[model samples]
Target: TRRHRCRTSASQCSFCEEYILWFSIAQDILKYISPRDEIKLPELELPNINELKQQQLKQQQQLLQQQQQQTLLQSARSSSKPKFTIEMSSGGDNQSTSSSLSLNNEEEVPANMNTIAPVPAAAVAAASTTPELKVENNPDAGIWITSQGVFYFKLNTLHIHLQFFYSVLKELDRIIDIDALYYLLCCLKLLILNDECLETAAKDNRGFLSYCLEKLLVPHIWKIFALGHGHLNECCVPLLLHALNYEPGKTALWNILERDFSSAHWKVRSSAGTRVIALYSLLKPKLIKNNYNVLSVLAYAFLNLITSIEDVEPTVSQKAMCSLETLGDASFKTVMCALEFQFDTVINDRSIILHRLSKLYTILLRNNSTIKILSWEFFLNRFDTLSIESQISMEESGELISPQSIGGFNTESEHFIRKLNQIRFAMAKTDSIKPISSSIRVPSHQRRTTTTVPRQTNVTSDKVETDSIGSFLSPETENSDRSTLQLLVNLLMKFMMKDDQNQVNDDRIMLKQQVTSNI
Candidate 1:
């Protein structure tokens, strides 16, 4: 009974302490009120303090439990950080051993934490001497395609891969399996020509790819060109041709033309001509002016076109002419140079040469005033060297027309003047001189080379009188300089007919001098 009374007194003492705390809080609040206010105070009733003491004790215990749980959670987070471990073990069988393995707990921990299996002693022993198994990260790993079994390159190491590829490609010639080799070629076609592969991912690596193709693939490609009857030409040449569209592959393209234009297969030779034509068709003037060295080297390939122009095969020669014609007046200078060098050797083919010369001359005179003036200077300087029959023919044909007629220009000359005027007007409008005056400036070396012809005094009157028309003008260019020059000559003829004998002799001599000067 005495012990129970002591416990009740202890409980009462706890409630007294809580009551004191509440009474102090009430006093602090009343201090904020005004003393003069007539406010009525409500009757204060405190809860049974002894019972409240028990509830407060229970809440205190629950808070302490929550604090303990929080500490446990913090401890769990610390364990999750990287763990490093070192273990040493001694073994029996007359051998002493020490072994260790660092486990990344984050990855190695089992899902059922309680069920983690122990590492075998043998495994641990082996692991101690073994090097750390490194996992290398492949930058290109993302490009692997499993279904098609191909790797699309991201081009990070494209040059290195191409070097290795070219090395392997060099060994393909030794491969005994023809079928496998052919299949490899087909695979290369697809890999190198894929639009995304060529123009997108590998665009910057074009130079390396082009070099590889030239050094390794081009020899085999030439074989295909020579074999003309096979599917190889259709398959492989086109692949290399497509590559040539890019700047880097132009070397391989040029090599193909250089090597194959003389190919035994007529079809291959004709195809070479066609390719040259196509290449020149796409030429921009900027490229012609800026890339002079490359164009000079490429010009070596055009000699094949020149010789082929006289080839026995009409089909082949026609293709060559078509290409030469595309070069416009630029070809005029080249062909004239060639003719000057090879004229003696080509005497047997003179008619054919003359025909081609006439075509080129007419083409140039129609488009370029510089070539027109230069060619006229050249023909006049060489007049005496030509036969009398040839001279008369030229006069009738209007090929040797005088320059005085330029002011009273014909329809063709009028068209040319109109074009020149348009160019000048365009330049004036833009206030830029780059368009017309200097666009196709001829090189100084291509200007007319001076030739001296002795005066033609030993002439027959019949030779001067007979003017057999030559085939110089095409129907499209009807109002040629010839017609204009003829009109001038006709006026001189009537002037001679009306003059008296003494005046006739003087006027005739003057007329001859005028005609000679014009020529």
Candidate 2:
């Protein structure tokens, strides 16, 4: 009772003078962006000696550059500013240090000058040679060249190393110890695909992209397929799909597609699913028809594989939904026509259909440009077709579609209705064309925008787009805007009037049991 009264004043309490929270929080923040995650940088093979050497060399170079720049300004301020000078020194065990001034002044600096400073011999060698490749307003090329320069020079200089964009991929494949390869590939493909240097390199060297594809992606396709462990970078297939559409025949996209479609690995299989969307979307614009037979096989494979997983991880489920929604483009509608006849036979499982429904609902719930309305979007927007197909299953006495306790049909139907309206409203706003009839979708895929997926493209079907390539536009895509409006009145009425006398009977039985127990 007297403990509080006897307690010392607030500042007098025994407390350790520690800032663990701040330190721990700082550690966590660093963990979020730990440099170890980057694929471009090689592992630190050197000890503190290597690091110190680098630091010393950096300091020396800085000093030399300052002297040279100081010389340049002095000369510019004076009569003579011709000699551009840099410095280098020897490191541990005769390791030479080179100082490079990246932003040196424009005046021609000579290689030799005592008043300036001694050029690190290696620095002098590089200065005596050609300048590094310069990319003009192109990041991809710069990335590619920086990457290439390191490998080309065989200098093994880690700090001032090349960007090594393409070849870094090959190194990653060799070095990554585990399934990290997939994630690494994902990071790198995303990096390289969007890199300004790689793009510039591709533009500057017309054949460089193909060379990279052949070296980095093409050779590994078979190994990726052969491993069949279902481990693949989610970005890998889509990036390839991007390449396929980017220049069409510039790279061997068809090969990657064929391989992924046939791959036994579920991860690879799922990638194939999205790639199918990419293929159709890509072909839709050009009216280029890929092999329907292979496409058909992929469809069955995708559905069967999708349905087979009794308990799917959330990421897989989410990605599968995305892949499906992306399939919704007008091109997919064209493809689905051929697929509709087979739906009853191919997709009869009630549980799978429900699962598909749940996933479709999720995708539509999150729809935007990034989730490029692939065939799945086509299927969801055309839920009427799905319901018709479901009715066939019910009639066949093959277990009616049941949502696995995720939500009730009424809620789902309403969600579906709301999403459909969004699609319609979005179309109305985008097309500036009101529907002649409430049910009609707008002229489809006319004037489709050409921006690829973006950050926060969490929209279910993230958009897929191509750049700096031949433009292929679609006509049928415009038809999709017409698949408008909200809940189907008849369907809602059916749900409202659904027979549920079994529930009453069950309740009566429960009441009787309760009375008997009380007696």
Q: Which candidate leads in lDDT?
A: 1
Query: Model 1, range 1-519, lDDT digits (tens) per residue?
Result: 011122464344554444445434533443333132322112121123344556778989999999999788667756774432222223442232211223334434553253123333344445446679222222244232211122334434565434434443564455333333455454455445432234432455433454445555655555544433344444564454444444444555555665566566667777776655444433433323312223332343444455455555678767676566555454444434334222212222222333334444444445443332123223332221122223333454687652222212242454333323322232123221111111112233222233111111112211333232323333432233233223323323433443246654654575456445544
Q: Give the true-structure RMSD of model 2.
A: 25.7
Structural similarity to truth (TM-score) of each candidate:
0.26, 0.25
The sequence of per-residue lDDT tens digits that candidate 2 reaches over residues 18-59 is 222333453345335434432231111112333455777898
What does candidate 2 score on TM? 0.25
Q: Which candidate is the best by TM-score?
A: 1
User: How much is the lDDT of residue 299 in candidate 2?
Assistant: 39
Worst 10 residues of 2 by lDDT: 481-490
Q: Cα RMSDs of all predictions?
A: 40.3, 25.7
Where's the lowest-lDDT run of ten residues in candidate 1?
Answer: 451-460
